[model samples]
Target: MLIRYTPGRTGLAEGLRRAARAVLYLPTACRLARDPGYPWLNAGAVRWLDRHLAPAMVGFEWGAGRSTLFFAARVARLTTIEHKEKWRRRVAHLLARRGVGNVTLRFVPPSDDPGRPGLRPALWRELGYEPHKPEFAAYADVILDIAEASLDFVCIDGRARVACSLNSLPLLRPGGFLVLDNSEWEKYAPIFTAAAGWPRLDFENGVWRTTILRRPGGANG
Candidate 1:
């Protein structure tokens, strides 16, 4: 396993570890730079998703990008929530040009709200993300409108992912999967803790990590 970075604890050994990990991921980074259409996740996670996701499955994602395009082709229907208008439009154009018809893209931008519930203040401070961005609370809540335990898959790869994952936990049907990219970050520790009983698989490529959790017998999504 690659060593996780810890602030204020790095020394010569940690620096060397970082360099080694970067070298290990060089080829993957090069290939991804050349082909941006692929989901920007750990290769193993992508492979697992390819093997597991079925054409009849219904899905939702918190980010709209290559993943949106990738899932649009594989799933029966997909709903993507994007925070940036420009990127969402760009993805929409790609979908139109590629003749992908199964995706419903929704744009939800950040806004200031005083009372919107989300990640705790300490967690936000630790993550270096703005605590005042209340739009993510609403963005995550978009899935609430769908019937509980109806969705087959949910992927959280965008902003406020912690909030998204927590909100999404109840919407996943039993045996459904929840994919969370960038799972190595310390800020995301809460998700693993909150999803205590989920059967989890973690794919790591030294640089990037993705965690897939199977919703076993529990609450409906």
Candidate 2:
């Protein structure tokens, strides 16, 4: 399932290869956690990271949990933020069992009231958080509070796209990469558009859309 990059079409083959590599690299005892249903770093995002960027210095994945263990293996340090303590604990336990040592997981309670009436209470019970409280705001605040200057790579898989975008950009070093999954979602388009100024590359329709706005030597335009 190797997809080569053609002139016009984005090569999805590399991404697939990277994903396969991640799976193969996983220990036999922990292979089941890498399945597609995992909450973090879905198959598509994993493939994209493998193809476009090298392993980063500091990697941040918002709302991605144990599902990103494979990606975590590649980076020097990974910081994963989840709003629910249950998810945090679950991911922490999984990482420990897998002997994954590089990740630091944090549980940040949400700041806004869960918009839906019944949903908030249900989620709170399920996640072991207090009911009727906003959980996402705290998550956003903690990320902003981090002292680091720039990040090598960032993956936004949480709520608050605008906040994520603002917070993430400052962390990206020059030439650093930012990957936002589910960009096709209507809410994320504005953030995507706002990122238009950066030299960008995207993979859509099973192909790469490489947009090199400013090359090393000069601007593309």
Which candidate's TM-score is highest?
Answer: 1
**Local distance difference test values of all predictions, in order:** 0.80, 0.55
lDDT, residue 79, model 1: 94
Candidate with top lDDT is 1
- In candidate 2 the C-alpha lDDT for residue 57 amounts to 66
Relative to the true structure, candidate 1 reaches a TM of 0.82
- Candidate 1, residues 106-204, lDDT tens digits: the string is 998776533334433333344444433365667766666777678889999998887777667767889899999989888888778767888999999
lDDT of 2: 0.55
lDDT (tens digit, per residue) of candidate 2 on 123-162: 2243343322245545654565555445677777766654
What's the true lDDT of residue 135 in model 1? 55
RMSD of each predicted structure: 5.3, 12.0
TM-score of 2: 0.61
TM-score of each: 0.82, 0.61
